[model samples]
Target: MNEREEDLRVPLISFLLCLCVLIGGIFLFLYLFVPNLSEPWFPPIALILIGFPWLLWVLTYIYTCIKRCFGVSRNNTDSNRQISRRASTMANSRMARNASTTNGSNNAKEKQAQLGSASLNSSHCSKSEDPSITSSQEIEMPLTTSAPS
Candidate 1:
């Protein structure tokens, strides 16, 4: 068998063995102590015996799930903070490089000033426009059907 399957085999076999033992013990206990199955207390006692282990297992599973969720969220927040730091550092370095390059060139400065002014003008134009009318309404395209040759 493969390494992964071999690793799983031991745990799987142990779990099956434990289950078999549990079932055998329960049956043996019921047979030895409770001969009368129809007794009022027998059913509740049997149910409790069977359900208690399952209840413990379910509670354990839920606790693990809650722990996993918190762990994942914690990891995500840590990763996000790392990514934000990296991005900010990269942006700062790029800005520094641009500043250094622009110092030697008048053309670069002129281009930067033009881009800034263009952005300002665009922002102003957007602010002056009526909010009720959308860009889609301002520009309309005509629909045309292709004629078969």
Candidate 2:
């Protein structure tokens, strides 16, 4: 009932009518002109009639896939711009935070210490890395042996 649905309805109905006309015309031609056609010729003629629409649909699908792979869609371009904008905003926020922290009168040694500690604390543990173990110091392992029979 809405404008969008009504717009789609007209085109859809027209397409179906055109398809019906095409199929009907093909059958009518085959019936009239190929009345004495042999069995061997019948399958090829029928296949050609049926396959035209199928071929068109397949070609259209492939064209759309190729276009999508090449990033020709407007929606894809819009999403890329949005992603870059968000990344830039995050970087700007981080820069502002760093500027605010270093604005104090702290000397080089104190500033370096504060920055180092902040970095160490701010670093998050990834899913694959354990948070409980902080140091890279190697641990001694006990040697395993089979019990004497």
Candidate 3:
């Protein structure tokens, strides 16, 4: 409540004060400056019909200008989102590059692991075969297996 009072109360009070003053000034002008036509209400009514709408247009233009200056426009929001997305993409790419650069042993370890796995598979295959091992073990195994079956 206190914060709302501080932020909104003062401004709202000032706005209402100024609006009252403006209405008073307009009434005084219409009463004094504008000459009364033959009819009692025509001149005052004409001023209201013309000046009030024109005043509304001018206020609308000023409001749009202020909104643009504050960066609350739609284009500003879309552009800010585009910038944020690009920044995140750039951050991810930089992290990937940094990781690859700092870890020099990663490639060597990967290659060693792959070679060890291949040799382990060959050893398993050889153990499963129970025959007299020869120098031409691979050739003999394939020939014997294919010839019989």
Candidate 4:
């Protein structure tokens, strides 16, 4: 299984176990505590109704956790894509600058231009100040139906 699918497996199993425990406890409680109320079906039926909300809560929790994993990966992917676009743009700009500089060198008493193209090429190709810094910005968003688009 992939990461998101793996993420759900443990939670789902735990939820099932919890539901079983809850239902078992409800029947146990009715058997022991509710003395003289002897109905064969009422105990199981009561357990089903009472344990339903707990089951729903567990299911919701599992779903939210799985969604959060996807959410984080998606944000990272979008940021990485944006950074790659910028890098490509910068590289193309520098290449155009270099090509123009090479072609314009034949004029008599030609002087190298600082701001024209050469300087821009040098500036962009220079080593980064911090190599470990990622271009992606992380923003916290609520993981719910009511979250902003």
Candidate 5:
């Protein structure tokens, strides 16, 4: 209650003081130009002086009202950016998970290929009937040396 009252008091006092000043200025103008009141230029100048501030205030009020209706603010955009950033992060993490899964499957396939080749070698060795060709014997291959530098 006290805070609200403090907030209202300053603007109320400032507005009253401004109103007093405007009215004093008008009164002074009237006293000085009483004889020229019938001049064609007086009414328009006086009306504009009095009406312009009110016109600006009405425009400002309407602007605020429209802004409220549209529900636009800095916080909304910041939160939306945060949400998009989080979604992108999640998508990146999911892609990483998928890539790791794919790599694991590829490794598993390589292990299966190695095991099948090993089994084929074992079967070929078992089918060999020659006594000279034993499983433990290692065939030697000649290595060609690069031409003498």
Candidate 6:
């Protein structure tokens, strides 16, 4: 097949072989120790030190290889970039909506996309010392209330 597929397959197969060797080594070590018939030097200390992180390294290698096989090359770097992009998009939309609402006109919104992109500045934010509000502006209300017959 292709070189890319070949590259992935090679590492995956190598890791699988390493994993098999790890399993066999563990079983053999346990079997030898459980019997207690072997000499003190039967299981070496070098093996113990190497064994500590060997499985973890092999598993990671195999995981990367399999992921490459499936064409999922995404990593933490891409994740960070995607998250930042999404955050910026959300912030932009929120700003646009707030600008449109404060200005109050659908036609104006359609006409001035650039103007609709105003940021929520300090001038737009106000604090009220009074809890309740009063307005002198009068509005026309329904003169009669109707109920379904």
Q: What would the TM-scores of all predictions be?
A: 0.28, 0.31, 0.28, 0.27, 0.30, 0.28
lDDT of 4 by residue, 46-143 (tens): 67756766787899999979987766665675565456545544554554455556666543113223323533343232244322222211122111
Evaluate residue 93 in candidate 3 and report its C-alpha lDDT on the 0 to 100 scale: 43
| Residue 126 in candidate 6, Cα distance off native in Å | 32
Clashing residue pairs, backbone N/CA/C < 3 A, model 3:
none
Error of 4 at 90 (Å): 24
Residues 12-60, candidate 1: write the lDDT tens digits: 7668656755765676577668787544555456566556666767998
As for model 2, its CA RMSD to the true structure in angstroms is 20.9
lDDT by residue (2-96, candidate 6, tens digit) is 44455777788677767666765765576577666544543564365446556667899998799777864546534643454444445555555
Name the lDDT value of residue 24 in candidate 3: 53
TM-score comparison, 1 vs 2, better candidate: 2
- How do the residues 92-145 of candidate 3 rate in per-residue lDDT, one tens digit apiece? 444444544565667645544544454334323344534223223433322111
In candidate 6, the residue pairs with backbone N, CA or C atoms under 3 Å apart (3 or more residues apart, or in different chains) clash, namely none
TM-score of 5: 0.30
Best by TM-score: 2
Candidate 4 residue pairs that clash = none
By summed lDDT, the worst window of 10 consecutive residues in model 6 runs over 131-140
The lDDT for every candidate, in the order shown, is 0.52, 0.51, 0.50, 0.52, 0.52, 0.49
Model 6 TM-score relative to the real fold: 0.28
Q: Lowest-lDDT window of 10 residues in candidate 4?
A: 140-149
Residue 48's lDDT in candidate 2 = 71
Point out where model 3 deviates above 4 Å. 1-38, 73-75, 81-149
